[model samples]
Target: MDAHSAPLPAAAMPANGFGRFAGHLDRALGGLVETVAALLVVVEIVILGAGVMARYVFHAPLVWSDELASILFLWLSMLGAVVALRRGEHMRMTGLVSRVSPQTRALLEAVAITASIAFL
Candidate 1:
């Protein structure tokens, strides 16, 4: 299945005024980040390919490509992290907790989140 078919995270659920606005904001930011990350992948590939050709085929190295690629890669990874978190893909604990009672689920979710943060 395509990534677009995946279910949305809890943050995107319906809510009151402020919460609804927050959800929209979160989704908008996620889309923007995802778009930029996709674009960066294309750009990094083009830059690296050109750099390779310049260094080998033409006997001239593109010194700036390495640094540029590194910075873009860092940004891509950070954006990916943000998207993963927004989509609740940061942990598998939720899937297991979902079968339990609400109270127990809440407690487990909190513990899992805290543990994840501590690990980070």
Candidate 2:
């Protein structure tokens, strides 16, 4: 509080309470989904590989391999949707939208979020 005291840098300031908690939840959820996806992919690959090797070497293919792989693929794809949200890698026409007013931007964002949620 002294006049001569050096000001703290922005990074040294305490994080916004809500923002910090939101970030923590986001990271935790992302990590959990990532782990599940990884495990699913690994399991599918191992099972499919084993099936292929067995079929080639012994002329025996497990009937369940294809079904198992398909189920895993579907589940993985669904879980993978959150990855795009987390990465902020979605495609958008920024050039056109950048010139819009803040109110319009907020409206567009709300509409987009609504549409995305409805679609899912």
Candidate 3:
């Protein structure tokens, strides 16, 4: 399956306006982060290209060439994580929880989220 086709567990059916808007906001954030990350990738590529040209042709690499590349990659990864979380794209283990009643499911979800945060 493609990246966008990955399935997500049905969470508490969002009924209220706040819930719906929150979902919308999440999707918007995901899109925005993806756009920004793509632009950053282009910038990284250009800089890396310049580094390669200078290193081969001029025989002098910039002092901070490797460090800059690492920082750009790190930024892309962190932004990608935010995008994944917003899209519910993280690997979620919800098999057993799917069989439970809504209330119990919510409780378990809360507990799991808390544990995840604590672990992080």
Q: Cα RMSDs of all predictions?
A: 5.1, 9.1, 5.5
Local accuracy of candidate 2 as per-residue lDDT tens digits, 1-120: 221123445587559998678768877998999899899989999989988988888798888888988999999888777765555544455665577887886777677779889998
RMSD of 1: 5.1
Number of colliding residue pairs in each model: 0, 0, 0
Residue-by-residue lDDT tens digits, candidate 1, 1-120: 223225767777776888889878877888998899899999999999999999999999999999999999998888887777667675465456657787886777687779868976
User: Per-model C-alpha lDDT, please?
Assistant: 0.79, 0.75, 0.76
The 10-residue segment of model 2 with minimum total lDDT is: 1-10
- Candidate 2: count the clashes: 0
Better of 1 and 3 by lDDT: 1
Give the better candidate number (2 or 3) by TM-score: 2
**Once model 2 is optimally superposed onto the true structure by TM-score, how far is the C-alpha of residue 99 displaced, in angstroms?**
8.4
lDDT of 1 at 44: 94
Residue runs of model 2 more than 4 Å from their true location after superposition: 1-19, 91-108
lDDT of 1: 0.79
Considering only N, C-alpha and C atoms within 3 Å, which residue pairs clash in candidate 1?
none
